[model samples]
Target chain A: MFPVFEIFGKQIGVYGIMAAVGFVACFLVGRLLIRRYDIDIYDFALTMIAAGIGMAIGASLLYAATNYRYLFYGFSHFYEIGWSGLWMCVKTALDGFVFYGGFIGAAIGILIYTKCAKDVKAHRDHLLDIYAVLVPLFHGFGRVGCFFGGCCYGIESPFGFTVHNNHLNPAINDVNRFPVQLLESGCNLLIFLLLLVLFKKHIMEKRLIYLYLLIYPIVRFSDEFLRGDGIRGSLFGLSTSQWVSIILFIFALVMLPIKTKKLKAQSAQAAESDAD
Target chain B: MEQQQGKKGFAIASLVLGIVACVISWWGLVLGIIGIICAVIGLILAIQAQKSYKAIGQKNGVATAGLVLSIIGLILSIIGTIACGIVCAAGTAIANDSRIANQLLDQISSSVN
Candidate 1:
């Protein structure tokens, strides 16, 4: 119901506000981390700009590509088309932003920016750690937006959520639907908090960022099952994302032991050399 | 030697992004090539950056791993590309056949009328 909040003449969706909130939260976290580790602010600013723009463009493009039907379909009836015209296409393109797409896009933007940046402080691990934490936190807000907009609705359940009646969204049928969007947001928040704790304990290194990869896909892959939207697809008896998750999880597990062993060996060598 | 945190951050970001790219575009041939290129290029740059940092007396192996991850991403991207192509072609074929069936239905209805 509150998906499209009218502010002045413009309509701002909850998703957009959530995105802004995520950005602010990320900036604050980044600033705090940079200050703690004596990282340069300019570098943070540069990377944020690159990543933010990348996420936006990437999410939008992916949404348009994946949901091409709804976006491309003129309308089942002439009366519907008469009201919107091609403007609906443009609107749908903008509105169908996907989270995974944005994540990849932002990462690419940061990578490219890092490659080109000339500043001395641009390549700091502390900055990376801050980003690592921020990505999940901000993405959490985006999921909340999804919930508010009723875009990523859940399946039927006995005691489930109902979309309030409003101009922007009708009361969604099926009361048995699980609040999957909220569940996702909750998971993301938990991850963010966990990351914060690790950072506070000074246990985080650049390697910790890779843990995000291992964790997020697992959460998303599981959540795919509860999603009521037509987005879920099973490939060879496993959900597409779940299949990807299995591979990524296996890869992470394989790498973890080796990485730990390598670090132990390196530290041991250092200790021996230092003693000599 | 203590590695500066900044260089490590850059490397990690590059590696994560590279892996993500490989996974996302894994459904398309062009995207797979691009993902591999990104991963490779990212890995090389990250490695160079890590080396430069180490040369200045900062020991940051984490950054080095980021470079290595990018290479892994490149391999995964290639695999993803082949998978994506097969799926896409199959999907396109199915959609085309469906469209033809729909057209035939319309034609049959008109003839009967």
Candidate 2:
């Protein structure tokens, strides 16, 4: 696994490079989408800033939440661990992020933007629908990043890659493991294509976000089963992501029909008013 | 007619901060943290600048540049932060477990002999 590579005597992470590429990709795609969807450019930019802030906060908080025991250990052994040691522990603890948390955070971010910007509030669903498509697009690149870095690795398997001398991920060194990151990346690609098609076709005009919520959780829930990493916290025999998946899946299931019914009623009322 | 000096100043500040962030991102964790903060502030400034430009019915290319640079800086800063964190963790582990270090030294000495 090539976690970090040297360039001009500076170490650069494969994960960071891929994520940066993903952001650029999203920006390019969002530019086109903004025009297509008639979204205000200024509002779009502000909303993205808000979402970026929220995603970072949410992802980091969840990472720290899952590893709170380490914090407790560091706190209790402050003298023993030393300031630098405690700082290192905090850094290591925060190095990991959960995508589900970022998703929730971005959603909250959009909600806040809608509330703050009345002009954009009218087009909330449109904004959400487009952002939904972008999520999978960005995540596709992110999963690939995770693969080269050997962070979100798969279970041990005979038919997989054997990583060696990976100091960044010693756990994966000399072991042949399932390529879950690639699998998830592939899944995200498929989801992205399908969502793009739906959005372009105007098939699920205002409900694309719910569609994403419906699909990704199943993939994530299954992904947890194949993940070999034991860093994330577990509850009731299920990892935090698994629990989040169940909640998001059920939320989509419940919210979809309600949203559909509301949209239908609003359309019917508009049609009647137009005829009158 | 677009004389929002404060907004233009924000855009300029964002651009400068973004440049600063990218430059410092390669220095590793401690400076990486500072780089990240600079990038975040730059991003906020870019967003605000964009708002001001839009309010005046104009697009500010400088703010867009700032936005892009800030993101790139943020990514690089994260990389530096994690890279140094890894180094620090490794150092701590070796300090805590001298056995591994001793084994390595013994391996080297036996090879030399």
TM-score quality measure for candidate 1:
0.60
Which predicted model would earn the best lDDT? 2
DockQ of 1: 0.03
Worst 10 residues of 2 chain B by lDDT: B84-93
User: In every candidate, what fraction of the native interface contacts is reproduced?
Assistant: 0.00, 0.17
Give the runs in model 1 whose Cα sits over 4 Å from its true position: A68-94, A120-124, A164-176, A232-234, A237-240, A254-276, B1-113
lDDT of 2 by residue, B1-113 (tens): 44554388888889999999999988866898899889989988888788878777788889889988987888778667643114222322232345754453344334433
lDDT (C-alpha, whole model) for all candidates: 0.62, 0.78
Q: Using Cα atoms with residue i matched to residue i, what is each candidate's TM-score against the true structure?
A: 0.60, 0.85
Model 1: per-residue Cα lDDT over A138-193, one tens digit each: 97887887777666667777656765553333324434568888899999999999
RMSD of each: 13.9, 5.9
lDDT of 2 by residue, A1-276 (tens): 788888889878788778778877887888778787677776786787777778877877787776564565556656765676576557655666778878888889988988888878887888899889999999999888888887777889987898888777777778789999999999999999999999889988899999999999999999888887655656788878899999999999999999999999999999999999
DockQ (Cα-based) per candidate?
0.03, 0.18
Model 2 residue A54 CA deviation in Å: 1.1
